[model samples]
Target: MVVLKKKEMMQCYTFFLLIIVVVASAIPTKADDQKKRVKEKSLSDASHSEDGEHNNDYDHEAFLGKEERQTFDQLSPEESRDRLGKIFEKIDKNSDGFVSEDELKDWIQYVQKRYITTDTERMWKDYDISDTNEITWNAYMKRTYGYGDAGEPKEGDPVYEYRDMITRDKRRWERADGNNDDKLNKEEFSNFLHPEDAEHMREIVVLETLEDIDKDKDGFISVEEYIGDMLSDQKKGEPEPDWVVNERKQFTDYRDKNKDGKMDKHEVMDWIIPTDYDHSSAESKHLIYESDKDKDGRLTKQEILDKHDLFVGSQATDFGEALTRHDEF
Candidate 1:
């Protein structure tokens, strides 16, 4: 059996959560084709019924909970600025004039934990039919697959509607059974819903990313492969964006450590999970760059309010929402 030290396990969890945040906030591109296909399938199911009976009530597009969906809607500039100011104040814990790296990191972890806890509780309630505070694989599959105790889906069942969920959750169950006990305790269930909390799951994600980007199937990502998604024009034959050109240069110059022409697994892993990386520091610098007007490397509450537009729709701008929905988590 493979054994991970406690500190190593914590690092894996942190690295996994950081990747989740980055991927969540990243600008969508053609490289997300697989995700796009899944999304498109859900949308298609929502719009049309195979049996010709329109089931528009099924909201296949809903990813967020009721409150989260409400909060995700756009706000006017004035309202957004007001909201941003409150957010900055909360993150600047200790009533400090500037947010420190520790403060920023704490805020990020808080947000991520809130999301995971909310999602996990929701799933637990759904599968825990006996109110026993634990879920067996049988109960989970029955609820998710919409099957009865007889071990099969009923006739006239909308099996197709849940095919994706079934497939995804079945794999999740296998991975979540960490002790191979065929059941998930509350903690394990949480890890099941949010795999970033499970250290072993991170390797799977890294491998998937490698497979997705290694276009030539040579076990490494070339410079072209690294920037392929960014370089591709959404409108055929159009020139790539200037930012894409800069990114291509960045990958070759900075990311290609040791002057290697290709990014091997270790190089890719470093690029994704840099050693001693502090997400808080990076986020703080970005906030200061956008809001600081005095050429200082810090932000005052007023300065944040003044340049709130820059932070809108960003993770830093929604502290209030995270707090307001705190009880749900």
Candidate 2:
């Protein structure tokens, strides 16, 4: 048995306490680190809460008119086949069995025009309440945000149905108002709605898109940030979901073209907008690829009907709407 005097025991206790303090100071507490991360995320989210508009890289619903969207959804596969056959007939203006590259290009242009015209008319009716063929800032705010006579939204008033839209449109209004007149003519309004149509406006759209996804404010998107934006509901400190894991792999493999472990502006733009190709042309090429059974460069009516499933689903045959509808797209 060993026994120590009081003074000796007191000195030993002090030495033990010093060692405990040193170790405690060396390691960071998990809870503190988590709290700090949460605080940073909260501040970042608050700063960009109003800037919630996102370009749907994979869908086209924004381009479709309401009636067209509904009508397309209601189509059966057989009806889709008939409708597509008619559309092909229209494109095959010469009554030839096959559609040429020029004819396909023209049809693609017409489809683009149809979407723009429909969406423009709908937005015009909503914002141009005075039928003056222009939208003032006041008109835009009142219609979009549901502001009262005082020119501000009431404190207890219900949030606008499209609150994010109000923020996005306001920003666009400022940008599209080239003369800084605080008003938008029909042409300016069209540019705001479809910035991709205006070559100059495309840059703004690309920048905004990048900012929306770049969570850390580092001017680039890491694999984790890319997955986080794509899967917003994913919780911190939880096991990464399969989709997130797969997307991380994809980011490294494809999106991070420079192999830099992060995606820069050019890479992000390529992922989102895909350079050297228009959506309409892409859709046209997809259709031709699916239906051109004889390996010809063009599609024949018989070939399209034979592979009608590729054109129209059994639940909804109106695949044309898929060209502009995000879900089907």
TM-score of each: 0.58, 0.64
Q: For candidate 2, write residues 23-122 as lDDT tens digits.
A: 1222223322211111110001111111232212111221222223334556666666676677667778788789866676576566555655666677
lDDT of 1 by residue, 1-329 (tens): 11111211222222213221112222223323233111110111122222233222111111111224234234555655565566667778898677654665566555445556766676666667776677887776555444534233444665544443344455556687789887888788876655544566544445545666688899988888766633433577777654455556667777688777988877766664455554434444545665678866667778766654334343333312322343333
TM-score of 1: 0.58
Residue pairs in clash, model 1: none
The per-model lDDT (C-alpha) reads: 0.49, 0.51
Worst 10 residues of 2 by lDDT: 13-22
